[model samples]
Target: MKKEYMAFLCIVAFLCIAALLLTGCARTPEADIVTRKNTEALTDKAAGGTENRKSLAENRKQTPEHYSWKYNNDAETLQISADADILLPECEAVPMYRLSSGGFTQEQVTGLYDYLFQGRETYRVEEGGLTKSECEKQIVRLRKQLEELEQQEQGDGQGDDDWFPDDEREYLQGILDERLAMYGDLPEVSQDKKIAVDSTLMEQTGIDEREDGRTYEETTHSLECQTDEGDSLYVESGSVDTSEFSLLSYQRPGRYTYSSGIAVPVDPGNADEKKSENLPCTYQDARALADGAVQAAGITAEITQVELLEGLAENGEDGVSSERSGMYSAFQFQYTRTFEGISVATTASEYVNEEEFSLMWPYEKLRIVVSEVGIQEMEWEAPVSVVETVEKDVPVLSFADAAAVFEELTPLSYEGKIEKLSQGETDASMDIHVDAVRLELMRVKNDGSKREGLYVPAWVFYGTESSTVYTSDSGSAEETWSETEPTPWIVLAVNAVDGTVIDQVEGY
Candidate 1:
């Protein structure tokens, strides 16, 4: 009797416990979902399952064929029309890479030389600036000019301020006397002597030891050759720093003018005639050649932008228009680095504080100008060596979300321009037309160091902006002036992970 009673109590206790669990489980749908999710997660972990992770990885690999979206503001101040293929990493997660200063190896430098110069013989040129005879002729011409000016001053008895001023007369006389005296002392012009370029001779030209125990060295080599068409080609290749941040440049001084901000062929004498003719090569052909050259150098880059080098008709202060210029002298191409099949966007404007401008860090770039003669100019600066992957995969926000951020910040981005337009006009309106949106890697500086940076995914908008201003003379025919910029202008860049607006000039 005692055993049976104990068994009955035990059964009752078990039933009561079961009933309590059932009552607790009778929760709202939200609570039930949470419980179920927690159970499934635990079950998954116990079963050694990673289905969720695998699914995310798989999703990242799936790329869409194209991307399209349209948005317009209520006031029509901003409009976006996007119908472009997704030219970015299709993966849901992207790996960030650490970059350090790097440059080319000897083999790579030789490969570059072979690709550019090939079988052509190279020469060492000492530029003969203004031959001795040229100097004598200049001195004679200046003396004649001074004599004429003196005669004019004596005959006219006027200051001639409208033409040459009194200061100019003295300056011309000084220049003439100096040149006449220095003619006999002028050094003989050096001749262009034939020479051999030893690609292996990469001599260390400079070394800098920093306080941080970092030693940076600059090694350089140069080769000069005359083209088959009698044009001169000067090639300078070098590396700066430990891993060798490399540079390879090509120049044709006679054919093109080069500056830090521009690379254009010297204006042809028959520019007006060439204006109607086609370029030396089709853009397709030039692109192909450019691609081949890049490949030869063993560079991983994507061509981001291309522009035609055309001449402009300058309007002089005298209100006369100069001769209209040519169709295209060269095709300019810009390339950015790529990692894991994704390329970096060239939209970021380099940021350097006024105090640090002199010691600013160099960024990576590859710009080439292809002309009729061939690749007239190329600049590849500050190549990087990937140290390690920061993350195997980092989840990023959707394009829609990123575009929303762009919309929110568009006004702020052009706020200054809009305010300026509003001034001096009774009415002013700005219309920003965004045409292309690309997901590309952006170089964000690492914490506390300008020398290091991490490449993260970003959405960059490309389009044009037009602003129209009107003047009202009491409604007597409102004067309307409108300005339209060229297309493919970098509108803005947004961080895909955190939706932060990135200022290209500031480089956040």
Candidate 2:
């Protein structure tokens, strides 16, 4: 049960992230991706107190009435609903392009440094050494935790520290002891504070043979710096295979958990009565801040998702005690690459050899976390540089044909997994319902030795899956149990040009 509960929680978080990626929309001039809004029909229906006359028309525009797939046998059932539009491009054909990563120039590195450290006291940090200020902050945080633990042990049963397990007391003490020792031996800050460019950071790490017989290039270039305000910044450009991506993180030592952890928005429906109790900045404000940060980093992409970082409340369950206060902390935005005004389809799953794929080709994404105070963190990973166009106006399949391909391959993607998961149940069934189908660019690797790939048109499917089970005990009627999870996954990616299914993880 414990393992199942933990798995369920992970599944929920995965679905939440996937849903945000597919449905999130923050249009920029560079990425004019379609955003359909049927507000007029909704308003008309509300005014008339019934379904509006144009409801049918709007539904037609959103999804086709037919093309659903269903299958049933003794063990389970698979039902796929093609309830979303096959949003194809306006042009007759979509072009494919070759992509690769390259090294960063000295000018580029200098410019990035200037932009990141402008108007701030920044000092280049040597590798493997802790700063005096950050060290002191850690010591303070550890001491405070020890103090809280001690007080909790001596307090009445109603104290908030019940969530702090008694067994971890010794562990915290060990960490505090180490920090105290380190603090006494740390060096003070010097007057020479100007950052010097580490030329090695700009060089490309050529192919390296690993112990597992796999070869890779260390494409990431990184630098660590300390600010006068006790904040530390660690920036990395490029990734394991290339140097075009960027990552900037601001770490405030000993930050309160409630101030810097994963969070979701408060219920907007209750915002009126709970205005003062939730996030201070509105969505618009957060969006503007996020745009500015993206522009500062010189990134050209589309905002795929924006989420409010409203802290979690301490309800007796879920390990959070009521003593832990909740408040609005930050805003997180996810961005994806765009090609010729079309956003590339993105996914978390990698369907190939993990080590090889990561070292050669990985999905690119940009994420920014902003707070009322300022931008907390920014990351752009697995960036690609377009080398050339493989084909201009490449003819592609029609939506009808693509739908045919979607129906054919989706089952194969989930074939054995469903049966394996429901093996022990007496009476078990499953439903695979697809809610959205998108026409987007998919990166497929060029069959060669070098790190190169082509971005081709593919039809990506997204939706949910659910399962039910009925079990009986001795002399008792059967009890029903069920689990439903969003499958906003790239269930299958059908090549628009050839109707062949593209492996999302392998990039081919």
| Best candidate (score: lDDT) | 1
Report RMSD for candidate 2.
Answer: 14.7
What's the CA RMSD for each of the models? 15.7, 14.7
Global lDDT of model 1: 0.57
Per-residue C-alpha lDDT of model 1 across residues 269-295, encoded as one tens digit per residue: 333343224446666777887887788
Give the alpha carbon lDDT tens digit for every residue of 349-436 in model 2.
4244355334445566566665544555655556566777666555454455556545544554454445554455455566777656
Q: Residue 46 lDDT in model 1?
A: 25
Off by over 4 Å in 2: 1-74, 90-93, 102-118, 127-209, 213-220, 230-233, 238-278, 312-329, 350-352, 355-360, 420-431, 448-450, 465-488
Q: TM-score of every model?
A: 0.63, 0.61
When summed lDDT is taken over every stretch of 10 residues in candidate 1, the lowest stretch is: 30-39
Candidate no. 2 TM-score = 0.61
